[model samples]
Target: MAQAVELPDIQFAAEEAAEIQQNIISVYEGLTGRTLQPADPVRLFLSSLAAIIVQQRVLINQTAKSNLLRYASGIQLDHMGLFQGAERLSASAAITTMQFTLSIPLSFPIAVPQGTRIGVQGGDGSIFFVTEEYLEIPAGGTAGAVSAVCSSPGTTGNGFLPGQLNVLMDQLPFIQSVANLTATTGGAEKESDEAFRERIRTAPDSYSTAGPQGAYEYWAKSTSAAILDVHAFSPGNGKVTIVPLLAGGQIPGQNVLDAVAETLEDRGIRPLTDQVTVTAPTSVPYNTNITYYISRSRVSEVPAIQAAVTSAVAAYQLWQKSKLGRDINPSELIARVMTAGALRVVNAAPVYTALTATQVAQEGMTTINYGGLADD
Candidate 1:
């Protein structure tokens, strides 16, 4: 195999070039017995000319090197999606389950139309929208549950508590109000440039053929950028199980699952004998009870410290969700909590009775209680 040649760094500073020019002039004057003062027109012109030429040369070299690095297989890899042979996935809103209630029982079932805009006041005061329609409110019942997806994608949609979503759309007069029953999960930002690049680089080795497991995994992920990870399993003859995970190892909604199935079906990439099933991963919720002591100096900042710790746990949960089928390391999580400005973590009681190798953390929620000072 031929070794790839590395590009040489050719960047140079304008000031350095100017100093060299000055040194050359000084040598010339000393040898010729002619003094070249700073105020001299010739000296000023020569210095300014040298600076401009040197700066332009440096910029040209930098641009040339950058352009060379952009090419992959002789074609310039511009625009992330184009390089991957797929368009960049747009941002997707987070989806969760929400419950709506009426003040009075109804004799007949009322249909909450689909695309009915229900609003929820987020922790940051932003209003999140729930667009899914609640189709059935049982007769004589005051409440019904419906799936709610965030208006936008990202981590901002994940941490909303049950009562936090309490707004109703204007048209639904029969319904009193609505709130989320579970924290909205599976929200994520658009795929980053580097991530897209890494995926595309593997295209030749993975997605080039259709019958292999890698081909199935590649096509499944290519369906949506929101897809964080994919696991493909062939358990038996003609049975292909495809499990798609969201940003935080949470199970994707029905809509995402349907899309993946539909895309794979249309592609016809799988063998005629194979039976493909697209499904969401099973969710295993992991809750934590943290008991920690705060230093006397940080006692006054207890509230802030607690909030920080909670945020850290949430972040760790999201990270854990990205890798499906990975073990939930309680000790690692405890270490993260210790960094939240707390003096020490006396004990971290993860609700799980025993650690199982097969059980991965799907949804992680933490409840922290301060033990106050060590003496207390």
Candidate 2:
């Protein structure tokens, strides 16, 4: 996965208060051809004026920085995003399909009314799903499926995999069972400034009819903030496929896939000639088994060094899985652990594994053992 653009620290207003006051005094002297003493009344007035001018310069610096993408934040960033036609996405409700089945094989048609509720069995009713539309089972069929949305928006309702929501909240005469057929997904909080900024930077790609790879990537990633990375490619003629990796190597569930697909299918965004498909990235699993030693010279700090090494390894695991197609490299793990004060690191698992664009490396088991103190 590509990294975000690195920005350098910059100072828009480099002039200091003293510099402004000195410049004012120099100009005044040049215009009047007279040098005023330190106690002169006119010089005092010029100093005060320079102080105000210094404040104005600070405001000017803020105004200039607000116009830039790198330093802008809050409402300033929102305005920048608006210029690219990218509005920050508000929180959204999770969606799933609830299946209603008859108690027995019914001989007559059964109607599942809209607004029916499905609850998580044996749990509080704080979060639930409501059927978006009515469903009618055929005369002899025992089951019907209807799409549903969460009662509340945001990420709280997400991650409820299929078969988790199995209770019918509302009573239906012949419906014996109700369960979610798809994972609940697409739930997210209001877009963060960083996520919105990334979208704004790439918003130019959306100007076209979604034929370019970057255009497809933009739309797919914009579907949800959980999508940390997107890989768009065309394997054959007229076919474009997108593989998205979620935060922390969490695979995109069926509901997420469907959401992304629908987002890219907008007629105005996707060209008529292009065929778009959204899929989850393949997961390449690996285990973390390692041992590290500490030098005897630093044995007095064993406790602190051990804690740092453990934290370093844990962070390495997250970094390894956070992006799509990130290879499993033992050297990286070793480097991090060593930098954390480990005298030597002996990695036993995950020697090295390369991943394709459509695959992500996942961490399975982790064991960071500390060997006894060794020679310095």
Candidate 3:
């Protein structure tokens, strides 16, 4: 009888995480041909990235459509109507009209209005939008030249009132923090754990993590943390894996290595060889750089997915012009989809076998939606 066995814990090294993150970011930037905002780029990048994945399938669908068209030939109804009562001397004609719809993302860039005191409203359900008080528009100037003046009510829950103050005093990117000053001014790590914990308890999380007092103390103490990945399995039974920690940004090699180590440490394991390895970095080489990937098993499904996404986006593009649909650009949509797919493939490899349910999900699955009628 087989004994009740325990599944091995999969360790994600800091380095691996960082490496994956960098690759994903590279793909995203390549697709968009623009660097993301420094704050948080992953969510923005992935939200649109899914569209490209579907485009590959769209392409395949289109190819099939073209082939089908060859077999279909008939005089159109409109032309037949005009020729209905005409004599044999009056030649008959036909005109055919096709009906379909496409969907595409409307990418609109929003800039902060002038003198705009910007922040979300309400609580968790709040969304981002601009109001009258937030902006200071100049008379007879382009709408783009407005200045943002972030503000909020003095109530405790007034979302960004205190945040605006913090930004003014410390968080603003334009200003230098204590760490910058320390590195530049030459200061050592200061204070003790007791002091740090006391601050943590009394302070808001952000204030404790990023405020002047926290920054000065943090730098004063020259401490370091290392990440490790431990592999423990029977000989020839081991597996390797890489993960992305922050999935849409420029992550450095050292950061990747550190993140791997962090994961290993969490599992009480250390790297097998006590070192991290990574492939070469990728970047946005041009304006048309799109990246994508899929499981090997799903490769056959790419064409359909591409065609469907493309057709959908194209249909939408046509709708945008007017009730009378305009022609869609199939080629451009296909390119973006293919590029994104290629990128995903470039950075993919199995992490390990005998993994947990969540681990399997993280690696992701390849799904193909092939339910649509082809235009004939």
TM-score of 2: 0.82
The residue pairs in collision within model 2 are none
Model 1 lDDT-worst window of ten? 68-77
RMSD of 1: 8.1
Model 3 scores worst on lDDT over the 10 consecutive residues at 178-187
RMSD to the true structure for each prediction, in A, is: 8.1, 4.4, 33.0
lDDT tens digits by residue: candidate 2, 98-138: 88888787778888889999998777998999999989998
Shift in Å, residue 148, candidate 3: 25
Tell me which of candidates 1 and 3 scores higher on lDDT.
Answer: 1
Residue 344 in model 3: lDDT: 29
Off by over 4 Å in 1: 1-84, 92-189, 294-306, 351-360, 373-376
lDDT of 2: 0.86
Candidate 3: segments with Cα more than 4 A from true spot: 1-257, 265-267, 277-281, 284-286, 289-376
Local distance difference test values of all predictions, in order? 0.67, 0.86, 0.28
- Judged by TM-score, which candidate is best? 2
Candidate 3, position 165, lDDT: 21
Which regions of candidate 2 are displaced past 4 Å?
A: 1-7, 15-63, 295-305
RMSD (Cα, Å) of model 2:
4.4
Candidate 1, residues 1-376, lDDT tens digits: the string is 1123566654434436857677767876888898888898877876777777677767765556545433322223345346446555666666667777888998988777766666666444365756576567888999888777777666667666667777765567688888777666556677656445545654543444445676777778777677877778787988988888766565666666866887778545767777899877766677766777777766678889888888877776776666667666677667787887777775455543332322347554567777785432
